[model samples]
Target: MKSVFRKILLLFITVCTLFVVLKWDLIRYGWQQARGQIAIMYNAEPLAHFLENPSYPDSLKAKIKLVEKVKTFANAELGFSSESQYEKMFDQKGKELMWVVTAALPYSLESYKWNFPVLGEVSYKGFFIEKEAIKLAQQLTKKGYDVRVRTASAWSTLGWLNDPLLSNVLNLSNGRLAELILHELTHDEIFIKDSIEFNENLASFFGQEFTKKFFKKQLERYASELYDYLLHLEDRHTLNKFVRNYLPRFDSLYQKIEGLSTIEKENQKFYLIEKFKQDLRNQKFKNPKYTDFIKSEIDVNNAFLLSYKRYSGHQELLERKLQTQFDGDIGKMLDFYQKNYDSL
Candidate 1:
């Protein structure tokens, strides 16, 4: 029995050693992410603490109260999870928490996916260290992948850890703040494995729809807020329409250039991208919000375009289905997907 036990222990040690040797990069990346998550969890304080703290600013406290109301509304009215998420606050102290890196083929809309332990396959990866994200982007770019790196203010743990309301989120307008809270909560409600685009679109749809309902119920007092939110929605609609109309043109451009040299293809790709930006500049918007967004906010590469599609591609379809088939019942629409996602 002693000899058998010793052999098993030796085998286990050897296997672990081999895994570390072969997957050192993955281990390192996971360790960085774990450290970042652990830091946030450790620093988080319960909402009651901040609400009761005399030294805390009244303005921030009010935002905290608004968050509490939003969470309750999402749970009691919208049928999202009643988990302990957003019950705590994480003060970022004006520093970004994570940077997300997304990559795609330069000539096609296909995303460059990374396979992980539990997430299976994902199109984007997050880094706690910005430099590390930049390093990865450089490497992918060298390999001819179009890479986009952007800062993320909030994320969900899928109930694994109680997510905290980030301080930056409090700075958004009242309507946007509510939407952001509901959007993250939607992840807790349902997440389909390996289908990042579908999961994101579902969350976006519910988030926007729930926000509309919340403001509508309070419109007597929040009329101005609702108007502002509607304007924001209109701008979003305009951007979505632009992308929907132009993405096919991009696809056609790529298809026609299949026989071109790599350098030649890259030149043409960027030329077309500049033309797209010019067209965006020429269009009149309902608000000045997208002017800066078009000029400098985004890199407007294949990865960026696909990122928009990932979040909003199926929104109209989902909205139509909700109205026509589900009788405009968001709860029933959610139930159908929760039960039928695998088949989808």
Candidate 2:
């Protein structure tokens, strides 16, 4: 009995050691990310201090105040959390906290998901270092994934940590700043696990609508910036509409191409991309931003579509539903999303 007990003990310890050894990389990733979040939570300084700094630029000071205003309005008018998240701010000293890498197959719209603790399977992975993000992209690229890396200006911890307005977005127009603040706040309001698409799209929906109303309410104060934002939004709408029509058609065509050799498929793909670019160029947009976009080489792949779709998919249908059924009331829309969150 003593010999059996000893053997069992040895086996258990060996198994445990092997498990830890095998999972060390995953463990380190989770630990480092959690530590980074905790550090940010602790490093944040009160917004009042930043405002009181006489040496700070007047423009940035006003943007910081705008953060508070948006947070207050979200709490009082939009019924979002009255948490003390936006009470503090952090200046990253030109260092970004993370880069988001989104990956998807070349032919499918499904995002390549990475499973992490707490957040579950997220469609995009955030790396504290750009090199790490690039490493991931390279891995995904090796697997035939089309990956896109975007520098994140800000992110919320879903009420788990104090989210601060970063210095990265201090230069955005007042209207754009408010839009970003509301966007992050909405994430805290209704970020369901395993429903990032719903969470982001819902946030984008509220962000745009709430910005329209928020700026309209203060239009007299921010008229010029409001015009800039409105024009920006108009271009965004136009671009989204074009993407919605073109990509699905492109995907359909790609699927229908039978007996095409690998080289032929490559040629067809480039042809489609060029044609889409031409179509975008044909449509004249007032925003120079959109004009610049059409001039670039736009790659249409699963990653491209997946990333865009998360923030803007079903937007037209959703807006129509809210406008027609909910009478365009923002509160009603929030209530509807909460009730039918999963279905979305």
Candidate 3:
């Protein structure tokens, strides 16, 4: 019996050793990233540090005050997690915090996923450097993957790490800044693993609603910002509706075209894509940004839509549910989802 137990322990150790050897690079990269972030946190000065500085301009002070106000409101009014982040600030000196790289098959909406320890699987990967992300994107493109890299001004570690405010977005408009702060906080407060779409969409919904409510309290002062935000939401909703309706059509084309010869299917897909773009061009969005986005988006592969879809797909239905069932109270909506997102 003791011999058998020794054999089992030896085998387990062997397996662990092999796993470590196989994943050494991944482990090293993750550790490097974690250490870098930890260093930043260690060096980051608390908000009080800056406030006490004589060189801190009034404009910067006001911005920090607004962030504090938003944080207070998120806790006292919205009933989001009482857990706190955004307690410190890191100025990255005109650089984005990270760049996100997303890849997909040329003709499929499914994204290439990367699995990391603790984080599980995520559809997109973030690199602290731009050239590295571009290189990876180019490599994936060469392998026939539709790849995209976008600058990410901010992101959350889902409470695993202290995410500090960075200089990259310090110049954001007051409304946008508040929205971003609220959005990131929501992620810190509650997150589901291996669910990028759900996480992003929920955060975005809160950001929009919170900003609107925040601005509405001072409508006389925020009228223009509020108007612009509403118009953007209207445009986004229209775009989401258009995409959701067309998604099935795209799926059908993929299915039906498979029966055709490869050459013929390729030709048909091209024609369909062009048709999709032409149809989207005619959409009457309240904000021209949506029109321009569709134009740029159609030029890329189906994978181009993955992240956008994750963040906005079926958002109109969600908005309606919030209004009809939750009485548009974000706290109630959040509570319902907190208890029910898995079923969803």
Give the best candidate by lDDT: 1
Q: Candidate 3, residue 295: CA error in Å?
A: 6.3
Candidate 1 on 1-344: residue-level lDDT in tens?
Answer: 99999999999999999999999999999999989888888899999998999998898898898788878887788766745888888888888888999999999988999988877788899998999999999999999899999999889887677888888888888878888888888888778789899889999999898888888877897788789988888888888878877999899989989899989998998899888988887766777767667666457888989988889999889989999999998878878877876521
Q: Which candidate is the best by TM-score?
A: 1
10 residues in a row with least lDDT, candidate 3: 297-306
Sort by TM-score, best first: 1, 2, 3
Q: Report the alpha-carbon TM-score of model 2 versus the true structure.
A: 0.90
Separately for all candidates shown, the number of backbone clashes (residues 3 or more apart, or on different chains) is 0, 0, 0
Q: Tell me each candidate's TM-score.
A: 0.94, 0.90, 0.84
Q: In candidate 2, which residue pairs get closer than 3 Å at backbone N, Cα or C atoms, i.e. clash?
A: none
Clashing pairs in 3: none
lDDT of every predicted structure (CA atoms)? 0.86, 0.80, 0.77
Off by over 4 Å in 2: 1-22, 297-300, 339-344
